[model samples]
Target chain A: MNEREPGIDRRQLLKGSLALGMASLLTPRVLRANDSSTVTLPFERGRRPLVAFPQKRPLMVMTTRPPQLETPFHIFNEDIFTPNDAFFVRWHLANIPREIDINTFRLTIRGRVKQSLTLGLHELQTQFEQVEIAAVCQCAGNSRGFFQPRVPGGQWGNGAMGNANWKGVRLRDLLQRAGIERDAVQVRFDGLDQPVAQATPDFRKSMSLPDALQAEMLVAHSMNGEALPLLNGFPLRLVVPGWYATYWVKMLNDIEVLNQADQNFWTSQAYRLPANPCHCVDPGDALTDTVPIGKMPVRSFITSLENGGTIPGGERCTIKGIAFDQGHGIDRVLFSVDGGQQWQSARLGKDFGDFSFRPWEAQFIPKPGHTYALQSLAINRIGESQRFGARWNPSGYLRNVVESVKIHAS
Target chain B: MIPVWMFLLLLVGATGFAWGSPANGNDREQGSILNLPADPISFQPGPGNDLASRYCLMCHSAEYVYTQPPHPREHWIEIVNKMNASFGCPISDEDMTPLVDYLVTQNSLQPSPSAQHVQRDDLKETPGQSSTQSGDPQKGKTLYGRHCVTCHGPDGKGDGPIGQALVPPAANLTLLGKQSDQTILDTLRNGRPGTAMPAWKNDLNALELNHLLSFLRTLSP
Candidate 1:
């Protein structure tokens, strides 16, 4: 990733989804540093022989505490569903709570609903059906650090996104019970993410009327089958499936239904993307337009051995990696065993539920002495394939380029 | 000190239990507060801290900082120089000696230890089997493809796609055995500690790190 600070270009809608991937397996706890901190080691170390499980270790993306850095960008998880211990955290304010008493905490859901309701964690669990999905939560600016020219935000790499098996009550269900007013046009979620301006504190976001009603939307309180990891927007968070995690509000203290869309800077002025279809605008022409980045375009990469790989003859190889598009799933994965010359469509494994990731594979029989060049490309049902570059957006939002690999048979 | 607005806002928000309010979690999180006394936390640096967590972990993690294996002096300088130039670390020329001293000593694996100090860690690093068992070879193959191949070439021979990104061009893994296991471990874990090599602890688990190490050992001359 080039490390030049290219100031924000007014060109495309600023919908640039970049998370400067500064890594470290940090959770919210990392940001909520109180006077002194310590960790009590896991008592059952003997039961866990290696205390260190270092297989397929994912790299960490680092981001600093705000005041130390600003939001719009921050540290991110190397993986899509960041591990609880390693979720990148970024907030605009310096004063953050070290801990919020669960007993005293509450998630208020109010707005244009038939009935205004107050719900408790246990009540939430007992009353509604618990639905879980492994979806990725990515900041709007995930990978902003890689913007050929730098921007003034948390310079993230690819780590801000994280996948999680979120469990919680459905937002749709809650809205229905609240009796969403007949005229309500949008639903807003204001987090405990510290209101930027106290005088009029405004750090709010909302989903459209239809999205708020979708079944995939959730008011989650748990991650990875455990109580929500604290740094992961614990107490409560919004998990929006298949969408950028920016909408996944953490420490959600308020959920309000409104008759109109939120007009706060967070929405109206921020997260906006170009409404045009200019993927590869000339640098000169690129200097003018800007737009909001939204709905991550379809993209995939072969996570298995990178572009240049070498294996002894007749080696059985398992090709692995992940792919993502706005809504449509992975249609087919094509492999180019004989370099990028000829192509063969490899079999994609079973589909993991709706939005969760499914591991795909391709087995190849190798020959000795000569090296093989392999590359993989994914296409959705609509038949759109991942490209080498999504075209240079000044913000460098989506780069779902196809990944290639080189293999040698000794 | 508690900000009035924060405390007041929270109090009102918490107790305002209206006619229909959501339930509070009541989840007793004992270890929630960072292990610190009742005081405000600041991102300030400390004195004689010797490799403070802030300076090192800003880019890596504490887990990476603590468990690192040690390295020889020259290799350490190569790392320090890299971080200062490549990764944007502000390592002053003055801080070099002490920083290196702390790392080389605290993280040092004494070839001259009191022999009785043999720990299990020593056992694991002693040139284990050749099967690439530390991590899922399948996973490593992919990770290598994604990360390692960028510099180590397609076949661990040091010619990679991102190889050009490295100023000195990436290290030739097949030849890392010249250094001891501790040196190799320390470098990988701490990322040359303060250099561009980046402490890799956050990205790799010990096993995965071990497997990558195993793979690199195979690349040695």
Candidate 2:
């Protein structure tokens, strides 16, 4: 079991050294006010710098204070399980915990329970039946940059999502230990992060008691078989499988079982989607009804060949990518080399789990000097496929539009 | 060869030391600490730029404002009011107009070309001569120290304290001596798309930009 540690450590070290060498070589000696190195996304004002944070390789920087770092799209093609260092990081509040004492850290279960209990890291690890599952944790605004007519939040590209094998004790076991009362209605989670102002609502989220008791819900202390990074919530965090990352509260320290519904700002006001079947509304239309953003919709991506990339002409080339949905599992991935006109089945790769990124590949022979529009459509077991065009909304959430990449055969 | 039990004992010892033992009574050894890098970008100079720095930076960084898509005046007003009303930003009624005005000036979409030209004409009294004369590099250096040094670094190596944390990082200006003045001037006027670089069209006039460009030339080897 421990044999893989040396291999993973060596590989990471080599990658880190190579990346540093390339950065030094490509960096110019002279700098100007307007001359910062940048990678431009395929949208207006999409130029972003690549910065490295602790325990992470160079990733796209969206904000500096709360540190919303996005993984590069190329990392998706590397492996089915995203390396813990390469996983994306997002925090809502600025004053996040920079230090955590594992020995002193405690997971408190209180409110509406038969008994309040606080479990230390060692107790939580040893007393419960340890379980492991591979799941995809994605931000609700993963592809907000692609939204036409634009939106006003973090303008991220398609790099704000990642899949990983999470290891932890089940939340159900912890709730059972605390003994839920008959009046329990909801389970609210609070993290170590705090708002700058007292009046500003603290970052908190809740789910129905039934939803929280799902067997898949975990109070994870380890990610990808290692202690969670401080930025990704070190001591402990909640892992809500198949749900948006917003509900997977990082640096989780408190779990309060409430007798009534949660009316916090993050619950009632923020992260709301239009309450429609499509979760969409006409652009510029006022939202009459809204609901808290939940389960991620079906999505897919072509990770191997990027837009405007060149492929070998008059030869067979293997096109590869990843496909995933909010659990039901990807039924079949349809590949179109002619921009959705012709559809061909791509062979699906090994299954990690229902809540994991399933790899898929297809073969294509391109004619020399021909430009082809490549697209992938992921259909789940429930027959939910990606929309041909992007859905519009004021907040720009849940954009699972059929992604098209225009590439030329060399 | 070491016995298997002996090896296991050594492994347990190492693990305990690495994570810290409660018996040691050293709190510092038990927890891990991380020091995040500083931020370099700030709001562009305008009527209420100071107010924005005072109030907004209390909760988030300036990139939150700089990164937004160019919105209309109404959008800026709505966001500001939301921060005050919902997020509890402490802007008073008197400071509201100036704060919104500053935001609109820096981040709002540009007017039509004809109207823009008219505004430009109004700002510059001697627009014709401003382009003809070269600027003083010494004067440019002072301006660079004030604005460019934050992200570009004092030596123009893009190693500024805050620039270290930026994605794609701040540009290394020392290698740009070979580039033409027009290219640099154009970038200064229009700004690079999707980058933290903001256009100096409203902040700096043509002559001041030329001075900044002259100072930038000195960064090249």
Candidate 3:
């Protein structure tokens, strides 16, 4: 059931209610001593302390205020689905909601619609058909740290990605209930997070009308079969499968049907890649044209072994990793031991969905006292495969170069 | 409504409950709350340290700047300007030059030994007099407002809001004027263990610590 309060502006109601809800919430409990533990990523200026946030393991902390945390790379080897506690967190705005009361929480749909409808969590569950899909949510700058001539952004190692089983209702069903007007060109999504200052642009993102109606696009309430952690956008999050995590707005509560194209700061100025197909330009070259970053390129990682780690000497070791693409379903994964000079097919583990991370395993026998450069290449069904050389872009987005790990046989 | 077969499938999924299984109806029904940890890092103290703290820490912790790979002064300038023009950071034009100076000195890509990696033992062994030059209390007051007031109260009573949350709370600085400069310097450079006091050596230079010490003496009752 949808509710409409008469003579009330939806935007003002949302803001007023949010302020009241925040005021009534309990004071956040500060944790004990700072952990002071640290993990050094394999780059200069890569040493980061390990800190535990609410409902999280001690992850590599990128920043503390808005709480940008990265999943430790080893978590990927533990299971195919990233645990809810260890899923990476990133918030664009500083003043994220520390508490959410589901009783008052509403998912509001307005703008260019037949009628604005506000639905609660319970109605969203019972009134609509439930769907579940597994997908990888990856940051656009996941491996920005490894970018040569290092870019100025979140310098994350390959830990800014995680695969999860997202459970919720379809976005199309809700938009249909509100009845999208014929002139609707895009659907803009907003969340509970707010900028610290009034002058800062509110974090908002938009998708084309056609893309919003896709079956896989979900307003996910559950991650990995459990309630999402507060940092990971509990209550609700938009799961834009196959797209960079930038488009997957967290703490999602508002959906607007826009008659005109959105030129919001986030959509227009930020998270953009070069306009070229490769989405790249040479280093030191100024970008002449740009477009909003979209679907993720194919990427694969060797998770079981760490770089500069030792493998059992003169013996066969099982090498395990994961490969994912823009929902095209990985057709084959090729493994190379001598730095892409030769290749062999890795065994695919399971098929969760086209969008889910596909686990792959291979075997390697190394000689004692010698080091081998191991790399993995994934090719999706549409014939898109990773390149041997990395493509350079100013923002350091869509880095799907064949990843290499140098391990010695001890 | 879910069909009977799909309901059975969900039941099966719940019973099995492995990593990759589908939804099992165990999703949380109530709203959640989070108690975030306090920031444990601070900006490197220098000329424009106060301005950097006022403008930068408004949106994020100092770790964002600390963790970045060293860049040229021009890069830092561009980043600072972008923060003002694009991200709506309200840094004034007059303050921008000094702020850029602070960033450049601390995070320059030049081939100099990193101040962050200097060993605690080496710092302890170094002659303390070199850093104990005559300090300016006025400059120290500005630095204190930038860095310490959040945890240590404005009156140096260790009664600030965040300090109250700590296990071994922030120090009462008013009582420390009688202590030797070296002892105070060591405490500021190498933070007290088993407490919330973080080391300032990586963030504040020797002279800045001396200035802070000079200001702390003025708070004596």
Candidate 4:
């Protein structure tokens, strides 16, 4: 679509013909001072040449080694349930399984259970009552690039997140079948994705026993009513509704119940945030104590307007976006036109679930010669709202600040 | 000739092609490994760069070092230290200083002696003033297609087909509008000393360099 735009040259056509596998050099670009404020702005989604990966459509590619793909923002503007193919892909380890025979693959539920159970795919579908839930599974560092005092990690735009309808047996039911021991403290999950080097830490995550027993948590085998795309953990994955995707282990294979807190590298060293209410630490402040990143906070973004985009004066335009929280459910989304001074309530869309993305819309007429600061602030049921300034964290986890876009009135 | 299933198994074993599920039934998503383009970055040969190539390349490609926002010497030191302490990067204590020194020398936007005079002149060219007045976008496009299109990609998203293999990934040049022209010019001439960006001083003339800069400006919003 962008190829037809004026000023874009034949370079776009050349990119389409080039094999992505060839080696090349790229000149790095730095940010300008006038374009950005004291607070850092989110990186704009780079326009990438269309290339389809396995079981996925052409996505905005970030890194290819373990395959990191960001879903375009316009997809979010369409529906609350992000399509299975359009779902963003993130893998930590280099070795992910290529194929699994349904008959041979087994899910083992062992540690701290009275009766250890090993169930095949057919038995897993027939034996237990299949349930479905719509939930948002966002990476802990979804907007890491926006963090001030810029932390080092995956430089992600706002697309490292997606919401989907998952179908599977509840973790509570599966645990009941396994018969969890009373002294079980935590439940750990393991996936087929493994690191290449033996010395590297294995990708693993554990949750408190109470969180494990929540009815919302599911051992999902199917996404959006079909078998999961191989890139998105084909046969099985764990769905922890209203939480970050770290706990939603993909290509799930094992469930080990722990009698104590998980001391693994993934839990203890990585995916950690400050234990404070704001969940932020001062820049360069040595963290004294940290807890594992859990529920994502209330956040929202304007999708209709691009940063620095132009609109005609006196034109009535309807501004739209998506907002979600850590399962308390979004109470209301407020649109701020005159900076943060005045905010009007945007009309809310259908409720999918507490864990689903809630769409919101508002209409306004642009004023001539005025640059409107379009911002959306999402408030959850508990009255927790997004902050203007993003809280700083070392690993760049849980950035839920109000997102603002700048548009010119001409 | 091998049977279909056997051939599939052979293919999986031959290449570590164990990524997507086998196409069963009407599933269009069946495939083996995703052959993403290889990373285009390679450290320029030097004493410290050789050290980086030896140790750092084991876990990550040079893209990790190049994609970083140019940081201070202390920041590079902290990063190298953290890699050793936290991620268990194996580097002898003797080698740490040289690696850090190489990174600072390469990544720091601070001008080298040869580019010092050019940088001074560039700094004086304020935002409103066009330092690249003689630059030709048409000439710049030809030069870019020949030299840079592989890694930076056609539109400067750094999604060049080969650039996908990089650890840190390629730098998105589309965002350069926010930076001063001097910074971009310096990077072109110096080639980020330690990283994959090679110095273009030997490759292009001053006028040609200015033209390349002009072409890059068109990529920005």
What lDDT tens digits, residue by residue, belong to model 2 across residues A1-410? 13123324422332343333211111111111223434568886565666555555556777766778888888999988887667888988776765687868888999999999999999998999999989999998888988888887888899888898899999999999999999999999999987655567889999999999999999998888777777788778899988999999999999999999899999989999989898898888899899999899999999999999999889998999999998899999999999999999999999999999999999999999999999999999999999998999988799899999999999
DockQ of 2: 0.14
RMSD of 1: 21.5
- Cα lDDT of all candidates, in order? 0.51, 0.75, 0.78, 0.71
* DockQ preference between candidates 2 and 4, better one: 2
Stretches of candidate 1 off by over 4 Å are A1-61, A66-83, A86-94, A143-153, A195-202, A278-281, A284-291, A306-310, A337-339, A365-373, A405-410, B1-31, B34-221
- Candidates 2 and 3 compared by TM-score, better number: 3
- Taking all chains together, each candidate's TM-score versus the true structure is 0.54, 0.74, 0.77, 0.71
Pick by lDDT: 2 or 4, better one = 2
User: Model 2 off-target regions past 4 Å?
Assistant: A1-37, B1-30, B108-221
lDDT of 3 at A13: 34
> Candidate 4: misplaced stretches above 4 Å?
A1-51, B1-26, B30-37, B44-47, B109-221
- Assess each model's interface with DockQ, reporting 2 decimals per model: 0.03, 0.14, 0.18, 0.06
lDDT of 4 at A9: 31
Greater-DockQ candidate between 1 and 3:
3
- The order of the candidates by lDDT, greatest first, is 3, 2, 4, 1
Give candidate 3's error at residue B195 in angstroms.
23
| Per-residue lDDT of candidate 2, residues B1-221 (tens digit) | 65543343333222211222122232322154443433434566667876675456556666677667777787788889988888876677888989888888876542222234335435532322433148778888998886677567999998765445344456899988766676576556544422334444545677788788888887888
What TM-score is obtained for chain B in each of the predicted models? 0.37, 0.49, 0.48, 0.43
What CA RMSD would candidate 4 show? 14.1
The whole-model C-alpha lDDT of candidate 4 against the native structure comes to 0.71
